[model samples]
Target: MGERRDTQLDALRAVAVSLVLYAHFLAPGGTSFLGHLGVRLFFVLSGFLITRLLLEARDAAAFEAGPALRSFYVRRAIRIFPPYFAVLGLVWFTDLEQSRSSLTWHALYLSNFWYALRNDWTPWVLCHLWSLSIEEQFYVAWPVIMLLAPRKRIEAITIGAIAFSLAYRFYWPITAVPALARDLLPPASMDALACGGLLAVRRARGADVPRWMRRGWPAFAAAFLAVVWS
Candidate 1:
């Protein structure tokens, strides 16, 4: 366990979780600027590390997606699905706030798709869980894509995904801004994850991105700060 530990990552996780708690609980209007920053940090870090791991798995001359596919789905299922349902059920059934006609749909991570289909921002019952929904959606699709996607294709997808996300934000400034403003969801939120994945691949090829990011921490902090503060 100790061997697996990355001190900087551990520190960041601690900070991120703490900020999430503080942002949700203490931040005014059920949100906080600092708290929001915490989550962004997490997304970036998750991208960075998860991609790195994927690249490592790709190497070892072991690009076979079998192990990655099985391990990831299983771990994600155990860690996310059960607890998510448990919590969603608890909140809805107990009427923690209010009852609703439908919830299982959201529990299934179809909220965004539904939101795209219909539009129910109310019943903010498990609003926070939406991020997890996006993540689950990512797990369901990304790994399969990652497993099959050629190295160049994966990189292009990552770049394109990020670009489209940003374009949505820029074009639909009103819509994208709010999502980005929200702690959980940003307009091109998944791009950061993809970016991390890209970074991971670069690392696999012995092309260093981590060192650049670390040394350019000032730039990263500035760019992130602009987005958060804006």
Candidate 2:
């Protein structure tokens, strides 16, 4: 079971990271489509793992709530922040003599909004790290979701996902508010992550294998290929 979980999780992440890298390094025709799908898959995967971890915490006797929140952020920081700051340090060393601005805001995760506001902010090397900020913000708040809410309330998580995913679409002007554009990762981008959380909840209860999903994987695959061919 754990092996299957790891495989699917890796598959989902590998799909996103591969597409994002391709979109950056190569001029692939399907990059945009694949990138969108891949990013969504990442978010879904995140939700699934986060939900699983929270359930484990909920179930285990020694699992305190503090670790639930702390370890989540710690693991996230270890995975992301080190290389991220290294890039910033590297960039700062190389090009301050030629470039127009300082590295302050980018370090602060405010670069996205800064550039969006100034209209002068061109792309930089560590540009993709902006998504990391969004993910971190999600981590910071997601644990509380598990903390306050009852385990049986599955729709609560799903509704939260729906609300978040739909928020920017409904409130674009507010979303378009650009001061912290980098900080504000679009809710839609997180839809897949939330889907993963839902799946996690399913997994804990043996509901992980949705009837429709189990029944339809083959059909879905065929239809997906048909759509691709057409």
State which candidate has the highest TM-score: 1
For model 1, give the 10-residue run with minimal summed lDDT. 177-186
User: Which runs in model 2 stand beyond 4 Å of their true positions?
Assistant: 1-5, 28-31, 96-102, 115-121, 170-186, 208-230
Model 2, 103-212: lDDT tens digits are 67677765545455664435555455556655666777777787557777865766578567655444554545554342245463455567677777767887556688
User: TM-score of model 1 relative to the true fold?
Assistant: 0.77
Q: Residues 151-228, candidate 1, lDDT per residue (tens digit)?
A: 778777777777776565455546543443332333446756676667766666777556777799999678757666
Q: Which sections of candidate 1 miss by over 4 Å?
A: 1-4, 60-63, 111-121, 174-187, 210-220
| Model 1 lDDT, residue 54, Cα | 57
| Clash count in backbone of candidate 2 | 10
RMSD (Cα, Å) for all candidates, in order, is 4.0, 5.4
lDDT of 1: 0.65
Taken over the whole model, the C-alpha lDDT of each candidate is 0.65, 0.63
